[model samples]
Target: MLKLAVAPVPYHWPRARILSFYADLAKAPCEILYLGETVCAKRRALTPQDWLDLAETLRAAGKEVLLSSLSLIEAASEVSTQRRLCAGSEFLIEANDLGAVTRLRGREFVAGPGINLYNPRFLTRLHALGMRRWIVPIELSRQGLETMQAHCPVDVETEVIGWGRLPLAHSARCFTARVQGLAKDECALSCADHPDGLVLYTQNEQPFLCLNGVQVQSALSHCLIDAVETLQQLGIHSLRLIPQSEGFDAVLRTFDQVRRGATTASSAVEALGRLAPTGLCNGYFHGISGMDWVAPPQVPQGQASLDAPAPRKQ
Candidate 1:
């Protein structure tokens, strides 16, 4: 059966906000939740112990919890913290970088999307290293996934990011700090000001990307509400929805409805379009530009646009 999972928050939210968010999420319908800071280490509103405690609370609420590590490790302190997170928890760790994978050898771990497991051979090697599951890299197309699965020799749970902005890249330098004219080390937790991430625009005033501390993301949220059937056909085990600042509960309900056959994919897509103000894109999944929005097959081509506004409530 295909399961629904929530990814860790990729932005810097205040401690109280984080606590409140998880308190609400504890009752959410998703079967799995990832907890921890995955971006800059300086944005530690919650201590490592706080994340573990939250994970326990969610677990008691019937959700599987995993601790996620930083995608870009730049300091010895960050490495030490990650080491503690991996060693101290009974929960599985989501290894975002190669170092995490090396540290997690002989233990079951999840290969996060940041790790590039492009081909069958690499995946097999990781499986040998005790990778029990992996999220498909956002840059990989559906066809690419299908091809890899057809040739893969091991059995592992496969997951795809079903919603939220695509995390395109991570850097050692903080873009948010640079934008605020502050040194990286002196960044005043500016990322907390934009819980959904600070948007970066193009020369033509087009919304291009989002700068969340060190992580760069697609300005438009990625939606695969229309692709549930396709993903199931390809034997994907889980659909991961990254948490956003707002409307995430509705997003989860929409995906769950579609997965349960209570709603049609078209209707779900239409309803979801109203939730994402910057519109939705499945272009990366369809092997196109990550910013481009492709309409479902039932809808005519060109019906979807990058600048699409959320539909008004009738």
Candidate 2:
């Protein structure tokens, strides 16, 4: 059976909201819960101890927990924090960067999505360094994964972003801070105001992307409700669902039902619209433009433009 893991929160949620979110998740069908901040280090709504405390709580509920590290190591203090996260033995560490990988060489760890493991040889090296599983990057298409999976190093598991707004890029510059005309160091933590993320639009008023501190995500939510069978055929081990502000619990139930053949993909997609902030896209999974959605067996390519407006439920 394919396991479902809830990926770490990518947005700057309030501390109380974060606690409340997991409290609900403690009974969700998700088998694994990725705990900790993998985005900006400045979003300190939950400290290290707080994350560990949450992890302990989830584990007591029989959920497997993993701690994720920031994708970018910006400063010395961030590196030190990464070191501390890797030093712990209670939970699996999702290594999003080389620094985390270096610290977790001897320990069984998960290679997170941000770590660019493109080829089998590179993945093999990570496997040698105790990478038990690897979260396939958001850009890799179905064909790309099939090729890579054929040559997967020993005992390594594969996971993909099943649904949610795709995290497209990260930068050293704090976009939310810059938007406020404030310096990175002196700017107030403004990302918390937009729990989902600060939306970005083009001059034509077309929604293009979202700015969550240093991370820029695609405006179109990347969904794979229709790809569950393909995943099973490919020997994929897990599906990772990134946390969103609303409708996530329902999303979990829908995906589980779809995976089990209890619901049609069309029905699940109907329910999915209520969960995604924008209309869905799976183009990158089809070897097309990442902004498009391509259904299998020669279903006509549907181009989901960057200006795709958030969908409303009927």
Error of 1 at 83 (Å): 1.2
* Range of the 10 consecutive residues with the lowest summed lDDT in candidate 1: 305-314
Clashes per candidate (backbone, < 3 Å): 0, 0
Model 1: per-residue Cα lDDT over 1-314, one tens digit each: 57999999998999998899888888877888999999888888998888888888888888899999989897999899888877788999999998998788789999999899899899988988898899999988989989877865557899999999889988878899999999987888888889988888789867778899999998888999889998898889899998888888899999999998899887788888888746677888889887777777675465644434453321
Candidate 1 wrongly placed segments (more than 4 Å): 300-314
Cα lDDT computed for each candidate against the true fold: 0.86, 0.85
lDDT of 2 by residue, 5-100 (tens): 899999989899999999999998889899888988888999899999999999999999989999999799999999998997579999899889
Error of 1 at 90 (Å): 0.5
